[model samples]
Target chain A: MLDFSILINNLDTYLEGFKNTVLASIIALIGSFIIGVIVAVMRIAPIKPLNWIGSAYVEFIRNIPLLIIAFFFYIGLPSIGVTLSGFVAGTIALAIYTASFIAEAIRAGIQAVPKGQMEAARSSGLTYLQAMRIIILPQAIKIVIPPIGNQFINLVKNSAILGMIAGLDLMYFGDLVSSHTFVTFPVYIFVAMFYLVLTIPLSLGVGYLEKRLARSH
Target chain B: MFKSKTSKIAGVLLLSASMLLSACGKGDKETSGTAAKNALEQIKSKDKIVIGVKYDTRLFGLKNPSTGDVEGFDIDISKELAKDLLGDAKKVEFKEVTSKTRIPMLNNGDIDAIVATMTISEERKKEVDFSDVYFDAGQSLLVKKGSAIKGLEDLKKGTKVLAVKGSTSAINIRQKAPDTTVLEFENYTEAFTALKAGQGDALTTDDSILYGMADQDSNYELVGGTFTDEPYGIAVKKGNKELVDAINSALKKMKENGKYDEIHKKWIKSH
Candidate 1:
């Protein structure tokens, strides 16, 4: 039979792991949002070089596996005299990987906004930057809220990859505990529950926001 | 509308609760059957022995990437056992096993015996029976050649030690150096690679495995003689006294004939 006592006995270890997972997710979330906005702007920019750079970054990152990216930061970087703690390296990889998807989502959102909005603002003497800032981005963000929410949820789940690099995330500690105790099935059940604790609320919040946004529209 | 939303939440909660209940209900059922005849008698009739050994861990049982042949001290011992039993060393089959898979594979009869570099512990003895200790190993540390970290004592707050997940070394290091951060990789190779990449100050595992790493890379050296005594034993299914006795005698004969020394010298001494 599955024993809940192992979980109760080592509740502190699981909580510590959960804390790391949450921390990594929050940092990646904020960092990816900033990077995503910039890349989205660059993709929509009038300049040819900016658009190419933005497109290249999104395509290149989105194509590679998250594990490879995490390895590159965790293993590859140290060879070049750049050393980062596992937590830092994992956060950077997660943020960079998630940013690519966020950029694509925001780009789609930007395109969904009617072209007339941009033209109307430009005709009123707003600079291209001002027109994008004041007229286009706010509406584009609203259109992207659902997808952005989806990405955030994915980011939380994907953070499990950090466990591979010994980033001390929930999955890492779960593996350690399961192997030590040899209660593989229950340890994972507990891990899944911890992940659900983070994800279910985020999902519900997203649904609430989506409903509110839909009603306002 | 709010009532509908509340019902939806309740539905999800109910569904998850049922799933959890079902999972808990499906308790592990012990497989029972008529006591099979001794394993030695079965092996002789079948004309072969299936042994599970690690395909990683350099000196212990790593597979050569080029030839696909597993070569290590553990491999040699399994072959010796096969020769002693079946009159031919080649009458043995080697299956790859990791630390995590070894016990389940043995319990389920996926493999007849496990000759992997498995450490015998009191807790594990409940699940499986072990032959007399074939090799003595101990938990030790591997550090870069020029590292200032000398041993486990040097591991303090801010010191990062790399080890493989699910390994006793990982657990031992955590208890030994509670303040020191331990980062576990999936295997010794990965942990050693991390050490080379400057991810950790030292890598902790069995000295036998560490010797293998040091053999492969001149830049690393084994530091701090073994801290924990880790005896390697060949494990068979629990309560298999006949098989255990046969293995113990085979091991004794090998030692008496000086074959054990030769194999140990060939692998362990050279490194």
Candidate 2:
């Protein structure tokens, strides 16, 4: 059995870390999904400028490491007169970085859907937006959910970067507690379990949705 | 009947979860020395004083990697104070704190007092009370021991100074060398590492912390005298006169009885 007396003794501090991690992940998850969806759509848009803009965003963010993206947002943006809290910076950077991947996944899914779907919707008098919203998107969403879920799990793990800026997230707490307690292994194992507590369910939920979406398909 | 039982179970689970959440935060803040003493009384009236400390700082404090026990100068001071306050020095709890969150942790009643080589500054005084300067330190630069950089004045134009964000050193560097770029890192070790890795020409922080790094690596040394005074002090919550008085009295006694000097020599001078 794992010796957890130290963990039990310091459970309160770890819980604070857990709260910070969960909150940061949730915020990043929502923000990234929104950004991913928007950019994914733009990447396939008809207009030349819009397509280039989206392509640039996706490529630029996708190439950089998440930490660099975070620092860029945390430090770089401040130079241009925008300031953000560590949480916001971390969450936004996590979202934007992961969004590139999410956008790629979603774009792949949309492309996998037949051009016939868009064509059929257009022939039936639906606008491009309407076709994307009602017809093409539903199938694309189902196809992209699992990969997007993977990106989300990564996002949750990546939330730790916020601590570099003192975001007070779970990873920050972990770093703080472990450095203080000098028990990095057990502290991390506890944090890993906490992450599993959030992500395991997500994985299961994704698996379930993947199956159900397959069935409906 | 099933619904009632289910609801009862849910209620109990909720209570337990909340208990775990509050358990970590349940300790009361001691502003005046009395609250700290009362709280100490509440716990040590049962037996144990949990003192939050820093484990990253060398000479001042550090966690021994092998034993997983934090030990250093500040730790020794707290231990001695515990002996005076609780009648048994061993009945103490240690928590780690960083510069940014140390004050918040103290304010939130997480630890009784912070003995983390905290610098006494005017801005910090608004939130917490300080015992007299227990450790004399100031903002200074640490570089590779053989480096030619003598002091802040000697740095070439466009020199980079590594410092942690929100640190007084960062503000100090900007003031002293407005044209230089200051690369802010998260903590002491990173800044030091950055200096070693050639990310920056010099690392700036309290000399005590720099000494900690120096103790670990001979290649690096404090390059200049403290450019700004950064007197270290023991911190307690603002308005906690009881705990404050007990700590200050204990500190005064520690200094008078030569326990302070003995501790100083043992952790600092002996090294």
Candidate 3:
């Protein structure tokens, strides 16, 4: 039988872990979104070095495994006199790692927009930046919503990496509970439920946003 | 219409979640039957016993990357048990288990016994049966040789102590040094690596394990001797009395034949 007793006894531990996980996911989501947008613009901009830097950041980050990035922040940075707490390190790693994919999605969406939209705006006396912001971005965003939603959902789930570095997230407490009680299956199922509590709502919210945006257009 | 569709999707998710739970409940029943049988008979029937050993603890069952084999005190003892039972030292199959995984893995029938650097405790006794203490170990601290911190006493507020997850050292330190922050890693290697990377002020674990780490690197040394007695034992599934008795007898024979001392000197004293 699944041990409900382990769950009841360690509710505080689970809740603490749940709190940290939610905090890490939220911070990473916002951080990655900002970085992703900036890099997306830089990659598509008419500048040369900016395109190289943008391409380099995306290619370098998306290629490496997430654990290595998290480890770099957690265990690597201290040698250079940059010491970050586990939560800070893990969240920052999640942001930097996920931003690469988000930037890719945004860039693809921007490209999918007809070139005439940008050309037409620039011909009508709008600057390139203004055309992008006014005419191009709004349309690109609608096209990007589905893929961006996918990345955000992935971002939430990948926040579990925080647990590996003892960021005290839900997965970390799940490991603690399983080790403490020697009950592995039930503990992880409950941890999954906690993650679902965060992710399911997020997924549904994205679906709803996609639908609403489509209707408004 | 959209509201109805959204509700339907939510309904499907809820139904699937319940299905997963019930499926797991069914799995629990299938495994219980095998657990009721005596493990000793099962080992004899199989002709070889699978024992879980740590693949990370340096001198106690660490996997040598070059050789592709795990070697240590715990591994040697496991082989001796296999030889005593199955009449050949090679009759043992090794599985890697960490401090967090060893107990569940044993209970789940993944291994016949756990020969990892496991500390016997009353709480764990409720989950699994332990043979007599094979090795007497104690909890201690490892820090840089010139560290200002000396021992458990010096671990004050804001001190970050690194320990392996699910280990007694992690639990013990929380109780002993209530004010200090205990950061746990997945295994000893990560904890020790974190210590060297300055992630924590000290690393805490069994002195035997700390000795292995200290031996591997000259910069770190054990401090404050031992704070808590951690008697290592070979754990089997709970209620496996026959297997427990056989292990105890096998251990006694090893002690009497001077085989235990020989193995200890090779792994422990040589370091």
Best by lDDT: 3
Better of 2 and 3 by DockQ: 3
lDDT of 1 by residue, B139-178 (tens): 9999988888988889999998998877788889989999
* Alpha carbon RMSD to native, model 3: 6.6
Q: What overall lDDT goes with each candidate model? A: 0.90, 0.78, 0.91
| Candidate 2: Cα lDDT at A59 | 93
Could you tell me the lDDT of residue A93 within candidate 3?
A: 99
What candidate 1 gets wrong by more than 4 Å, as runs, is: B1-48
lDDT per residue for candidate 3 within B49-125, as digits (tens), equals: 99999999888989999999999999999999999999999999999998877877887877889999899998888
Regions of model 3 farther than 4 Å from truth: A1-11, A79-81, A181-190, B1-37
- How would you order the candidates by TM-score, starting with the best? 3, 1, 2
- Give per-residue CA lDDT, model 2, range B119-233, as digits (tens): 7878678778887788887888888877878998866677767777556676677788787666665667656655655556788888888888888888888886888888888
Model 1, position B178, has a per-residue lDDT of 98
